[model samples]
Structures are given as structure tokens and as C-alpha cells.
Target: MTGKFIVIEGLEGAGKTTAINTVARILNQHNIDDLQFTREPGGTPIAEALRHIIKNGLDNEPLTDKAELLMLYAARIQLIDNVIKPALKAGKWVIGDRHDLSTQAYQGGGRQLDKTFMVTLKEQVLGNFKPDLTLYLDIDPEIGLMRARTRGELDRIEQQSLPFFERVRQCYLEIAKQDRTIITIDAGKSIDDVTKQIEQILTKWLTKQV
Candidate 1:
């Protein structure tokens, strides 16, 4: 079988790291072990540099939302051409921490960028390229931010207001609803429960793949 690209997505503190681990474990259990892991805006070297700017800001130079969105796409295409696409061609299952959905949610929703521009950019750069499956962990922004706060420092995007995150979540939900390839998970539950849900989802998905 050819490689499948699976993405884990959520707002900050939605427990994506754990969900990624769970997905890997379940895939391994199914003997689908040739896995290539990637994180959005940072997989390739060029992408990583852009990621640093996106997260930490470059010398406190104010980053325009439109520029930030463009940087993310630049980093994304770099990773796709340099890392993800090659890995997939070699029969390695690509697991992503985030993908274009992030731009759709964060930039389009949170930053309120132009939807037409977002769509145009996505089509021009990505075309139809997308994850085979997406696991979205949904959580309350208030709770999510609290969890993020305990993790030390908040990044540039993480420092947004509650309403901003709420809009992001809303956008995520709206997109998820329109896409059956995307699975929504209630991340507000315990970690154990969340892991179990992922295992079940992957097991079923793998079965259908056969």
C-alpha cells in the first residue's frame, strides 16, 4: 500500500502531542511502521526558520497578519516539496502536527484575513494536496490557554485573546463538519480517554484501508 498522510490538529493545549503519539503507536500495532513525522511551518530547514519568526517574532519587529500567513505557506510548501512529498513517495506514512487547516483556522479565522485570498493562495500553492486523515482535538479556549500557560512561555500566536481562539475553534469545527476525512475528538476529556478514542479511530480506519 502507498503511504497515507495523517494530521493531528487543534488549538494550543489541545493535547496534539499525545494524540500524535497515540496515532503512531496504533499505526505501529497495525504493522504500518514506516512513519515520517512532521510539524507545520517547521519540517524543513527553511520552514524551521520561518517557524521561528512566526512563533517568536524576528527581533520584536511587528509581524503583519498577512505576512505571517504568507510565511506559513512558504514554510509549508518547503516542507511538502523537500520532506513530506519525498517521504510519501518512498512509501513512508507521513504524520503531521498541522497542515493547511491551521492557516484556514488561525489566519482566516483568528486573524480574520480575506477568505478569497486564503482560498486563492491555498489553491495556487497546495492545489489538492491535503492530509488523508485529520484528527481534530476540540477544547475550550479558556481551559486550553490555562494549560498552555503552565507550559512556560506563550508564543506569538499563543498570546492571542480568548475571542480570537474561540473564532479559531469555530472555524475548525465548520471545516471539520464539511470534511468526512476529518475526525473530531473531545479533548476536554482525560488523556487516557482521548488516547482510547484515537486508537479506536485508527483501528477502524486501518481496517477499511485493507
Candidate 2:
């Protein structure tokens, strides 16, 4: 049987990390063998290092939307070739905490990066690497930002203004509209409620596939 690729996507503080962890635990309890959980920009050393640099806002000059888009894809190439693909080949279910959807949302919607440019990059650089399922955690930008701020230090990206976050949220919604494989979840709900919903969705999908 082929391995399944599932991705969890959301803005910062949308509870993506918690959701992914909960889902992983559920899968383990069910004896779903050969499962691996990872996050983007870094799943391996090189990609993770790149993630740190980008997240920390290391680039001296103002990071243009185009530059940010390219960096994201750069990390994606490394992640897919080195981590995701290899794990899939080994018949493992790879659950990514985030994926290309982030690039399209943050770069395209948030930064006003061109969609045409993203498509071009996807075709040439990313190739056939696509998630089987994408779980989008939908939350209002204001609430998300407040939660993020309350949590602690904000990353360069997270520190972006409210308008930027609004754009990002819109991007996520747009992607959900465009793709059938994407599932939108109301992240405004309580964490347990959100986890239950995700588990139900995963169970249904896994049952069908298996």
C-alpha cells in the first residue's frame, strides 16, 4: 500500500502544533504503524537551519515577497527530497505540520506575491510532491494574533502587522476553496473539540484509504 501524506496548516497560534501532536497520538493508539510527524522549513538539519534564519528575520534588507517565496520553496525542495519522499518510500505515513500551502498563503496572499510565479516555481522546483490531505485550521486573524502574542516571543513572520495576518487568513480560505483535498476546521473551537474533529476526519480518510 502507498503511504499517505497529511499536512496540518494554520496561522501562528492556530494550534497546529497541538493538533498534530494529538493526531499522532491517536494514530499510535490505533496501532497505525509506520507513521512520522514533521514540520516545514526544517525536518532535517539544513532545512531547519534555513527555517531558523528565515523565521528570525536574518536577512539584512527588507525581505521582499518574492525572496520570501523563493526561500520557502528552497526549504521545500530539501524537505521533500531528503525527508518526506524517503519516508513515504519506506511506507510510512508522513504527517507534516505545514507544507506548500503556507507559501501560497503567506507569499501570495499575505505578501501579494504573484500566483503565476508560485505556479511556475511549483512546476519546476517542487514537481510531484503534494500532500494527500491538508487540514486547514481556520481562525480569525485578530484572535490568532492575540493568542500568539500571549504565548510569548513572536517570529519575524508572526510579528507582521494585523493587515498581513488578514491577508494570510484570506489566502488559506482561498486555497480551501480551490482545492478539494483541503479540509477546513474551525480552530476557534476549544482544543479538545478541534482534536476530536480532526480525529474523526482522519479516521474517515484512513479507513477509506486502507
Candidate 3:
């Protein structure tokens, strides 16, 4: 049997890392031992290189919007082919930090790229592949940015204007609204509270799956 693919999505500083760990713990409690964890734009060797370019601005010039979008897809496909697909086929669960939703939010919404075009690219690149479940942590852009700043220096994508992340957050909400597989969680709450909510959601979903 093919294993399930789970993804966690959110804006910067939305506690995705913490959420991922929480999910892993929940899965472990259910005896789901064979698992793999991946992060977008950097899950494999080639993907990691592309991730560096995408996250670090080139010295000569800023990366073009179109180029950034394509690179994300390229890295994603590489990770899929080399890592995620194989693990799933081998019956190992794959937990992902970020996925195609990020493209929809960042490039399509924030950059104001054509949504139709973004959908077209997604279809071409991913076809029918999608996460079995996506946990989306929703937070205000200002609060998220403040938390991000406390972490360290912001990366290229993290350095985007407040308006950009606002648009991104809106896109995430809109997409989550239409997708049953995507569960939205209020990430502004305390870590323990967020963890409790996530466990409830995951437990309920797993009960149905079983």
C-alpha cells in the first residue's frame, strides 16, 4: 500500500517547524514508524542548491519573479522524484514542510501573478499528486513578521514587504476555504494550545481514514 503524504503550510514564523514536530509525535503515538520529513526548495542535493539561490539574493541582481516561480517548481519536482515518491511507494509516510500552496500564496498572490497561469504550472508539474492532508497555520502578517525577525536575519523571501505577506496570508485562507484536505489552525495562540488543536484535527482525520 502507498503511504500517506502530509504537509504543513504557513507564512513565515507561523510555527510550522513546531507543528511538524507535533505532527510527527502524534503519528508516532499511532505507531506510524516508517516516516520521512522534507522541506520545500531543499529536500535533496540539487534542490538544496536551488534553495540557496532562491533564498539568497544573487550578488549581481535580484532574481526575477518568473525565475523564482520556476525554480520552486524545479526544486519541488526534484524532491518528488528523488525522495518523496520513492518513500511513498515504499509505504513510508512523508511529512512535508511547505508545498505547492506556498507557490499559490507567494508567487500567485503576493507577486500578483496570474492565478490561472499558476494553476497551469501546477497541473503540468504535479499532475494529480497532492497531499493527503495539509495543516495550515494562520497568523497575522505583522505578528508573524515580528516573530520571524526575532529568529534572525530574514532571507530573500522573508524580506518581502508587509503587503506581500498580507496578500500571501489572504491567498492561504482563500485556498484553505475550498479544500477539505487543508485544515486551518489559528497559530496566534500559545504553542500548547496550537498543539492541542492540531492533535484534535489529526486524530479526527485519522479516525476517518482508518
How many clashes in each candidate? 0, 0, 0
Measured against the true structure, the TM-scores of the candidates, in listed sequence, are 0.99, 0.94, 0.98
The better-scoring model by TM-score among 2 and 3 is 3
Query: Whole-model Cα lDDT per candidate?
Result: 0.94, 0.86, 0.94
Per-prediction RMSD in angstroms? 0.6, 1.4, 0.9
lDDT of 2 by residue, 1-210 (tens): 577898999998799988888778777766766898888878888888778878886757676667777777888898898888899998898999899999888888888877787899988997776899999999998898889999899888998888998999998998899998999999999998999999898888777776
Q: Please, what are the lDDT tens digits per residue for candidate 1 over residues 77-97?
A: 999999999999999999999
**In model 2, how large is the Cα lDDT of residue 192?**
84
Determine which window of 10 residues in candidate 3 has minimal summed lDDT: 57-66
Off by over 4 Å in 2: none
Q: How many backbone clashes does candidate 1 have?
A: 0
